[model samples]
Target: MSVDTFAPCIFRMRQTYVTDVVRMHLEIFIQPK
Candidate 1:
């Protein structure tokens, strides 16, 4: 694939990964003791 197309795909994947990590952290922090 061209770099133009490939770059956005990688960026999207990275965004999703970061979002998932943030969500997991929020869930852990919000859970009861």
Candidate 2:
């Protein structure tokens, strides 16, 4: 694949992973003791 196309895919994956980690952290933080 071309570098231009591959770059976006990698960026998107990184963004998705970051969002998922943030969501998981939020969920844990929101849980009641």
Candidate 3:
């Protein structure tokens, strides 16, 4: 649980979360009814 290792883990999780949010927004805009 060192800061060096933990920082990257947090960064990766944030990246994944942001990617999912962007994907969800794209899907909604691409198929607006």
Candidate 4:
């Protein structure tokens, strides 16, 4: 795979993973109130 294509795919995956984690934390800690 080319670096240009691979880099964006990896970046997008990381971004999605981080977003999921942040959403989970918010639901667990902020939803209780």
**Number of the top-ranking candidate, with TM-score as the measure:** 3
Look at candidate 4 and tell me the lDDT of residue 12.
100
Residues 1-33 of candidate 3: C-alpha lDDT, one tens digit per residue: 999999999999999999999999999999976
Whole-model lDDT per candidate: 0.98, 0.97, 0.98, 0.98
* Alpha-carbon TM-score of each model against the true structure: 0.88, 0.87, 0.88, 0.84
RMSD of 4: 0.8
lDDT, candidate 1, 1-33, per-residue tens: 999999999999999999999999999999965
Candidate 4 similarity to native, TM-score = 0.84
lDDT of 4 by residue, 1-33 (tens): 999999999999999999999999999999879
After TM-score superposition, the amount by which residue 26's alpha carbon in candidate 4 deviates from its true location, in angstroms, is 0.4
Candidate 2 Cα errors over 4 Å, as ranges: none
- Angstrom error of the Cα, residue 8, model 3: value is 0.1
TM-score-based ranking, best first? 3, 1, 2, 4
Candidate 3 residue 6 Cα shift, in angstroms, is: 0.3
lDDT of 3 at 32: 72
Q: How close is candidate 3 to the true structure, as a TM-score?
A: 0.88
Which should have the higher TM-score, number 1 or number 2? 1
